[model samples]
Target: MAKYNKVVLAYSGGLDTSIIIPWLKENYGCEVICVAGNVGQDAELDGLEERALKTGASKLYIEDIQDEFVNDFVFPTLKAGAKYENYLLGTSFARPPIAKRIVEIAKKEGADAICHGCTGKGNDQVRFELTIKALAPEMPIIAPWRTWELKSRDEEIDYAIAHDVPIKITRETNYSKDMNLWHLSHEGLDLEDPANEPQYAKEGFLEMGVAPEQAPDKPTYITLSFEKGIPVALDGEKMDGVTMIKTLNKLGGENGIGLLDIVENRLVGMKSRGVYETPGGTILYHAHEVLETICLDKMTQHYKQKLALEFADLVYNGQWYTPLREAMSAFVDKTQETVTGEVKLKLYKGNIINAGVTSPYTLYDEEVATFGEDEVYNQADSAGFINLFGLPIKVKALLDQKREQK
Candidate 1:
């Protein structure tokens, strides 16, 4: 067997990772250093450090990466208006940054291999491994679910019980969850069968939004201030990206703002149903669109929409380190140069109503758009413009008619 002197495991303090510490010790006889990343998994990090240490980890690295996540990863996607099939790519973009941090810590600690608790069938294993391949291709990746004898979640639970590793999961609430600043996604459980409807009443399952019934009767007003395409404030208060999202998430969640249920195609070629809570992200996307209406020109906005889709795919597929993503970022950054403005929104019962938008660089001219009269745009000029624009379509239709007559 190839020997590993030490290994850095992407530890979440979850059931799988809780057991992996002992499993690695017993099987490979290698010292395990646990690394737990904060990607907006709020309560998931509570007691994580203590638990990892108690579970026989030689060392632990707890990294607070929320700001970097929102600014570096989340904002760029928001700028692109990228959502994977109407559901925001919340968990999709979080993998690369976490992997980058892991590689950094591994090198500092001189670990021989990096390990993760991700399963063989899941998309995360691919996300985690691909990031490592892109960043540190030389390091060995120790995937327990792929190599170990533990096959089922039940068996893993049994191992946890026998080993006395502290865990929060149970058969009733065994749904797999991944939460972060962007959104919270829930899978497994009854979600495995597409026919079964999710039981929303379950505790610790959907923590982000209020049960639609519990929401307030009145609508809430929110104002987002943007400077060069990045959100700089909420309701006129200057704040960082992390704080802005946190504040909006509270308001949006209270109003039952962001809740998406969809069956999406994974990168590994399988359809999966996920219940997502993206309170702040939903607000941000809407506000960004409102600002873009006033800020971006017609040609730039339309072309960037296509670019945004490609950028979203790259982030979802764990291709964050590639040159194309950087190139896309450059293009997005240029479009956002004039994306400075404020968007007023009315949040009412899970609906976001765009109130008004104002920007110094606005292209909307009242004189040109007025129905009664206009100075800049002559109505007679459109006859020539339409003739040129429709020439190709007219030619195609004429040819089709001629062919039908024949």
Candidate 2:
């Protein structure tokens, strides 16, 4: 009656997943191998190994992938200027690398199936399952939410208590949260009702930063440099992906730079309301856009803008490992060839203000564009150019005049 001899479960020491360990063993009669990927969840990862094994997991694998996450996934998504409904693709894109590692560990541990704690109503279930399907199609997926008898979080709590499984969440104060290096998203509870304003003043409401009103009075200024659209340095100091993001997180969080409260359309044919705190990501996105204005050609910039919409959708829909995403990334990489520049920005109370930008690839020429009479440009040439440019409009107007006379 057991479907899998061993299952590799994508384990986070959270309420839902904690109980899932016991549920899987009871229902499936299989050994559960827990794998927790570290994508910069900070305090969320503390004592996860002990918790996994303590709660019926045969073994636990804690993999450090923060550097790879920022360098490979976050930077590329940033370069594409991809935003899922004007918010950073933080949680959306973070799932792929996590899922990728789960497949790897599953193979290493000879797991016949991969499992996750994602609920049926949530997008994450699709994200994790789709990526698993892409990488290792034969490996079965065990989504407990879709199959289990636990109807609600309250039910889950009751089950956990019955099974003697330890968890931090309580029915009264449970708010669903997903955290990574780029962002921390808060949902469920009061957020379910769109009318209820998010309690920003509350301790757990925002994990990354303070409220905009509570930010310091003085604005913070910093310069960021990019090479091939990837952020390379912060404030004139060169840093690797992890350090740059970490440094920006502290600076941007202090200034309350990135926060968005949105009710977004989920792929599961539902609308979900959540507050996302993406301090560092917001800063990086602003800086990248500013640099792109100078570095990229007008046509390429316009096309890429359109492409960014598709890119954002793909990432949001868990198509990160698909051929379309790969092709789009190639196009994005080619466009970034000239996207090397320095952008200065002012961060003040949740606002990212552009101070200045300079790039070797800037197409703007002072000699040609200056209002002060330029020797390099002949002003009289514009008369003929405008006449030719407006010829179609002029002909159309004449035709309309003749029709009116008739």
Off by over 4 Å in 2: none
Return model 1's CA RMSD, one decimal.
Answer: 1.6
Per-residue lDDT tens digits for candidate 1, residues 30-95, read 999999889878888898888998889998899999888888888988888888788888888888
TM-score result, candidate 1: 0.96
Backbone clashes in model 2, listed as residue pairs: none
**In model 1, where is the ten-residue run with the lowest total lDDT?**
197-206
Residue-wise lDDT of candidate 2 within 185-295, one digit each (tens)? 988988999999888877856778888998999999999999999989998999999989989999999998889999999999989998899999999999999999888
TM-score of each: 0.96, 0.97
RMSD for all candidates, in order, please.
Answer: 1.6, 1.3
* Superposed model 1: Cα runs more than 4 Å off: 201-204, 396-406
Question: How many steric clashes does model 2 contain?
Answer: 0
Give per-residue lDDT, candidate 2, residue 228: 95
